[model samples]
Target: MSGRLSATVVQQCVVSLGDVRTRIDVSIKRRFLADQDRVYPGLECPVPNDDTVELLSSVIDLYGLTREVLLLEIPSYPRLEGATVPDSGGSNSGQDQDQTDGHPFAVLSEFRERMAK
Candidate 1:
């Protein structure tokens, strides 16, 4: 079986924690083979390099296949174009101030500075 999948999803940007809209379009093809071992008595069947083949089962779950395909196509770390991740060591330049404000670890640095005094 073969089909095309297209979807749009909103993901959080790894850098800015902002909404990142992503579009995915992919072609899926799957071939199911039943009783391949029985067909060849002694010789081992060569495994295909690509993920297009599967062992035939009593039921073919199209919904599960579609969900998996969609997940594989989605970006693991979605980022907006031109957005930069703030440096971990902290920046002397005020340019990154706004960016760092929303960072989860921003408060830790502030607390450290206070304790140093």
Candidate 2:
């Protein structure tokens, strides 16, 4: 039997910082077993004395290759076109500011005084 498979994939483009859409197409051919050692013509049985003996099976898995292709085609880095990033000042810029709002650990000075035993 022979058949075709197709899919639409949405992926991120790292270079363009945008979404990439593509169509993937695959063709498959399948065969059935007729005999023990004659399932496939090109298949060869393993021989101990033969240096170039190759073992062949009657099944062919195409999903593994399809997944590998999808993974390889994915972008390494992807970002939005007009995304904005907030400015985080240099190391000591927010050091003197109180970040917590009325929390118990906000009073570090009192904690230090109590721990001065």
Candidate 3:
């Protein structure tokens, strides 16, 4: 059996720790064979071909499948446009600081150089 699935969820931003709204829409098509080692005739799986999860038995969990889809669709790091992640120094420039030029991880670089020395 095959069908479509859609979900709406809110995820926390990686940097800002704010709510990030996300939508998941996917086409699910699964072919269950009778205790077969491999699928045949140009087989198509519910998930992507590269990432396929074989379903056990004749039953499929719709709720679990929906949750899985939503988890995959959500971004690992969701940042708003024009929003900037504060540097490690914890200095709040309030958007006035020109962060485009200076070395963001200068301390790490310095530590690496010192180790080499």
Go through the candidates in order and give each one's C-alpha lDDT: 0.86, 0.55, 0.64
Segments of candidate 3 deviating more than 4 angstroms: 37-58, 90-117
Enumerate residue pairs that collide in model 1: none
The candidate scoring highest on lDDT is 1
Tens digits of per-residue lDDT for model 1, 1-117: 999999999999998889999989899999988766776777687767769988788899999999999999999999989899666665534776776667879767878999999
Lowest lDDT sum, 10 consecutive residues, model 2, at 46-55
* TM-scores for all predictions: 0.68, 0.32, 0.54
Q: How far does residue 33 in candidate 3 sit from its true spot (Å)?
A: 1.4
Best by TM-score: 1
Tell me the spans in candidate 2 whose CA falls farther than 4 Å from its real position: 1-56, 92-117
Model 3: per-residue Cα lDDT over 64-116, one tens digit each: 77677667777778875566766665432545246534766754655698899
**lDDT-best of 1 and 3:** 1
TM accuracy, model 1: 0.68
